[model samples]
Target: MFGMADMDPTGGLWNWAASSSLSGERVQGALAGALERTVISLDAEGMDGAVLCDVYHVSGDFPTLIDVYLAPETIAETTAASAVAVRLEVEIILPDDSLNPTRYVLADPAGGLRHVHVDEVETDDGPERRHVRPCTGDDPACAAAPEDKAA
Candidate 1:
């Protein structure tokens, strides 16, 4: 488990764009269905592993549930402060039946996983969303001696 970061107002950079008029009941139902269907699909593919789930509902807006699977070995080290950095070698299954075979890192100050490439991704049933902050080793924030927070 990771330490929970205070809800950062800028965290929406990594969030799905949800409609503002959705009722709480509707949002809950959709989130439940998405979670069930996704988990089942992943299991059928023999890729069932530990999952990290995040459900966000900032203020009174609609909610979004984001899930990712990270293997134990991938988590390099975690600080007491709940800061974790990991290199994930995996394929991101998009709703459009496309796969992004990219190495991602979970370095969001708000504890979110993000693609290293900053690009718009089309999902199977939603508006395209952009991946935030593409950080490489050369990025000062990603280097050993950090100067300022990059992402």
Candidate 2:
């Protein structure tokens, strides 16, 4: 579980060519279904696990669900003041045959890109939507150490 870094109005979200190589087997843990809607949720806790969020995409007309967890602590950070970070989650339902869900990104690489998979993906927020910041880390402020990675 991870939290959304408060709204950072400083920089732009890192954008890249969209990727869609998610296979039914990629998300092995996901219950088999016809593929449908996506749900995103956020929650906050104390110091230990201050924040957490999950994206659930339901497949087909059946009643199955696919869950993707986002960890802010593991997200790429470019600044130190993530102070305003807040938890934000959303869900969207797509038609049964949505080979493409508006847009997509490549996350969690595996034996090269082919084996790579999608992570923390939501069908609602597409490229048309502008993001203030590339979600900074959930920490009230960037860690004492700046980073180029989600560590």
TM-scores for every predicted model? 0.21, 0.21
Tens-place lDDT per residue, model 2, 98-139, is 122321221212211111112223344332222212223344
Estimate candidate 2's alpha-carbon lDDT, on a 0 to 1 scale.
0.23
Candidate 1 wrong stretches, greater than 4 Å: 1-54, 59-131, 144-151
Q: Model 1, residue 14: displacement in angstroms? A: 16
lDDT values of the candidates? 0.30, 0.23
What is every candidate's alpha-carbon RMSD to the true fold?
Answer: 14.5, 16.1
* lDDT tens digits, residue span 44-80, model 1: 4453542233333332111232333331332222221
Consecutive 10-residue window with the lowest summed lDDT within model 1: 89-98
Worst 10 residues of 2 by lDDT: 80-89
